[model samples]
Target: MKTKFTAILLLQLLLISCSGTISTLKKEYSFNTSSSLKSNWNFNPKEWALEKDTLTGTGGPMHWGVIESRKQLPENYEINFRVNMTKESLFEVMLNLDKEKYIRTYLYQINQNIVIGDGVYDKKDDSYGKRGGKSLFTKPMELQNNKWYSVKIRVQNNQLYFSVDNKITLECSLEKSNLSQKGKLGFITNGETKITDLTIKTL
Candidate 1:
């Protein structure tokens, strides 16, 4: 009777420990820069800059150094953000897998079209695997220029779900990519754009 009781107690302790570990692994994002309108980030002339916006405070000219999350993120999690397109052009928020290079997955846009694409670097060929990569998903919805639109993305395992303005747009599953690396999350803009209320929650 004592042996059985001890075994049960041990099992309970193990379960509790695992639960605690999981709770710790799921973490909230610490925004590196919070902007109102005319906001400026780490002014690296070589990689990033800020452009003026007549409607908004300032448009971010993000290139390589304007990353938000340097901390490791949960593999399977949800990410959402509010982006204000002050100027009409192509933009993206990227989750990258390369430490030395910018190989990553991107949520893309050009005028009103939205797309999700991935880029990889090849080792054997010693070149970037896919130039613009392939579109995993696309949406016909048009984004209004100079308006704020809420974007939501859920990535769990190999599946991805994308939504705009609280409406489901596309869903896709990816064949496991060989290049696996924990990466930083950031925004990408070609002409001019502003981002705010960026929030990420773990599943």
Candidate 2:
């Protein structure tokens, strides 16, 4: 009877340990209200606005607008959002953004191409430079202005998986990218763009 009780206790402990490995952190944003957007994000009011369940950013020649989340993300996570281009523009999703490390994945609406790159920050001048950028797909995907597209990105074990509208998918290794284990997520637009239905899940 003593041995049987000990085995049962051991099994319970094992179950608890397994459950602890799974994470339950999640965040969702609908962009339905200005108050929620102000509380959870940082952006320039002159360039971005929240209205009608959408966050819109207007850009022009030599002008790029950015909005960043206040919360930092976990190492292994998934992000989902929808984007609509008002015109031909450059839309970028930035992850693991810190003072020195970041990863940027962007789509050029003019060319219908997707690219991923590492960010370079200049501490002396407080500006960013370009580095280590590559195209994800060899063929350009069809893109149109004034149309909404669903975007999903998953990061796990130093690997990144990206997909758009469930039609095009790409994966890349980040093991040697020197990115931060955890950091903020942000979006950048070089022309008019609207974003909504942002969700994040950590594993």
Candidate 3:
């Protein structure tokens, strides 16, 4: 009887260990209400608005806008969101941002080219200074305005992966970059765009 009891205890301990290994870092945002947005994000009220479960950003020429999350992200994680560009312009996802450095994954609507790069942040001006970027595709991909597209980004062990509609995938190495390992997530736009269904999970 002692032997059987010991075996059962061992099994229970093993099960507990396995369960503890599972990740517990899933977060979802539907953008269905203003309370959550007001509490969790930083953005300019004049440039961004929430309507019908969508967060819309309206930027004019020389007037870019950014909506940054209040929570700092984990070092290794995945992020997903849906975006619709109301007009052809620059849309970028900023990651691992500190006061002095950041990583930018951006798509140019005019050419449909996806690019990733390292950026210098100017804290005094609250603006980006200089950046060096690389295009993911040799040829320009086809993209259209006024349509929703699903975007996914994964960061793991100083590696970054980006995808659009699960059709085009790009990877980059952040080992030598100056960006922080864990930092805030943000969206930057230079024209009108709408976003919804943002989610993030740790690896």
Candidate 4:
């Protein structure tokens, strides 16, 4: 009986230790200059700039590109940013980037059509593998071009939360074992985009 009691106590202690780091730590960010923005990112297609505290990028032949953080992110945290567009475009937040695989949370719009959704994707051998991609699980919201939208994302414990304009709009489980606890955080865009106020904080 004493041995069994001791085993249970050890299990409890393990659970507590795990939960200790689940309490997130915050990251601070402020837009000041072009160097500050460049210092925090790694981008492809190599045609992007930060001017007047706004970041703009456009240089991919396929009209698509990715800009990733220089540092990896913690497992559980909140990230927020504001974006604007001059024309129809696709914008995405790529998180938990474990090698060539990651989770994509996107807000896509084209000539008055819009979608707010997410998917799991892998890029290997010049091909894309998508599994359980619920790319449109909600209604399309009418968004004005050249107008900024406040977007927020949070991952805590076993769930992912999404919000726009300060309203929570979606939730999904983070159940994939391959999804790493530490990975790159970044944004994907097609053609032209202007982003500002990128901030992240731990849960």
Rank by TM-score (best first): 3, 2, 4, 1
**Worst window of 10 by summed lDDT in candidate 3:** 20-29
TM-score of each predicted structure versus truth: 0.59, 0.76, 0.76, 0.69
Error of 1 at 31 (Å): 1.5
Residue 3, candidate 1: alpha-carbon lDDT: 100
Give the distance in Å from residue 76's predicted Cα in candidate 4 to where it truly belongs.
Answer: 1.4
lDDT of 3 by residue, 104-184 (tens): 787777777776777554523543344323443322567778888899999998888888889887787777644456678
Worst 10 residues of 1 by lDDT: 52-61
Candidate 1: misplaced stretches above 4 Å? 1-28, 32-68, 100-111, 120-132, 176-182
Error of 2 at 171 (Å): 0.9
- The worst-scoring run of ten residues by lDDT in candidate 4 lies at 19-28
59-169 per-residue lDDT for model 2 (tens digits): 664556777777777878987778998865688887888865668777776777766667543223323344223444333678778999999989999888888888887
**On a 0 to 100 scale, what is the lDDT of residue 2 in model 3?**
100
TM value for model 4: 0.69
Alpha-carbon lDDT, every model: 0.50, 0.70, 0.70, 0.61
Candidate 4 collision pairs: none
Q: What is the C-alpha lDDT profile of model 1 across 1-203, one tens digit per residue? A: 99999999999756534321212234334333224211322223343433332112222333222333345556676776667756645556556445433323343445355776665433223234432355555667666667777888777776667677887476666445333334655555545566555556667
Which pairs of residues collide in candidate 2? none
